[model samples]
Target: MKFSRQILSSSFSLDKVPGWTCPWCDKSAVSGKKDDFRIIESVQSKSQHSHPEWEPFRITGTFCGTLICSDENCGEQVVVSGLMEVEERGWCDEGEYFSSYEEILTPLFFVPAIKLFNIGNNIPIAIKDAILETFSAFWQDLSTAGNKIRKVCELIMNDKKIVKTYIDKNGKRKEYSLHTRIDFFGKLKKGEREQKAYGLLMAIKWIGNSSSHVNNSLTKADIINGLEMLHHILELLYDKDYMRIYKLGREYNKKKGPLKHPLFGTRHL
Candidate 1:
């Protein structure tokens, strides 16, 4: 995943550039002006070469093109470079030829394919940095991104405290702190109020452990899936109960005051 340029969401007009996704806006828009695009004619030409099966034939050479976005708000610029080869089914109307030149587009380091989902704007500043860093690593290296996700998992555990209590066989009461992802999920009994989605939590732990091992080569899909799970964890833990819809629901259920609402929808603004 090593690229020549370190393309970022802010470096280019996110929505205007094709093959690019903004990790901030979460919207996808791709369009360019045809009039502003042109081929670099200086570096292109036809050459004659001899092949094993053919006596002699002319082949099209390399050429570069430029595309300028015209979406006044996102007028980004980019260059499309590639080489052309003779195609068997192509033709020239003037000459009786059954072949044509087809240009193969080269690498587009700044295209929209690299776009990532925005983690949203309502999260804590610290967690926001961690989320963005995870994505930033994702674009460069999958393994590195997994490690970043691990960091975010650790941060979540540290920022929130969960208590586990039990009555001992001897009739004594005991309480312990849940300090890790596994611990946080392990402390709860089946169907307990504090229990989170087990599968998602376990996957987070698995991702962290795998990323810590030096021999693992993580995949982009794996990192992204893990990141999405973490996103769910955050949303359920801290991002809910504050939206206007949730607020209205809470007001409508006034009888179920703050403590009685499972979704913490009993609180008022």
Candidate 2:
């Protein structure tokens, strides 16, 4: 996404403005004031699926608003900008998130809905880059998990398949086909729902939904919690000990960390 204007209009006094409000704290502070204020805006794209084989794309939209206090203590600000949905169907130059379905699907509602969608007020050096980085990292990790599962599936399928061969009777010789009456693997393996590999892959879908949609469904805390859950689940799937969790837990235990989980105890990486 891109922005057309940096300084929207010379910051007008709060009294002069009618319905302007801060996006951060959602406080109705005095708008009209003699301060170095300007309305800045930005545009960017968002993606849904993190299919390893599929490419990703960028979205462009504007986030316009005024910067109120520069001090960290009184850090509050108001912004108003035009933002479009993360086109679900169109093709994008930056990535491959855009799809055919977006064309028919209604454009995302940008107003009150966007306000709830944390657009981090910190205003980093590169907004688009930051969003992309978050999305790309998640996609890459999911891709890795997906690849591993696919390989496992292929191995299971091939191992159970029956192969057959035949020969022509050029010299009065003939051949017969080899066929398996039943699936030996099926009898040996448990149900699909009980398999750890299947569960791990399904969890990836849940993460994708939470991150892509602008339904204001998942909170910051929720995402973090989900990530922690996914990490542990993946560890269990791999039939491996969670070294990272253990190491981090040990560090936190010594420091008397504030937050605590049953297994981790507190310190987390």
Backbone collision tally, model 1: 9
Best model number under lDDT: 1
- Candidate 1: RMSD to truth: 10.3
lDDT for model 2, on a 0 to 1 scale? 0.35
Which 10 residues in a row give candidate 2 its minimum summed lDDT?
Answer: 101-110
In model 2, what is the error at residue 195, expressed in angstroms? 4.0
Q: What are the per-model C-alpha RMSD values against the true structure?
A: 10.3, 20.1
Q: 152-248, model 2: which lDDT tens digit per residue?
A: 3233234434222235656544432111211333344454422443444345345544455555354434433334443333343232234455555
Best by TM-score: 1
Q: Give the Cα RMSD of candidate 2.
A: 20.1
Each candidate's clash count = 9, 18
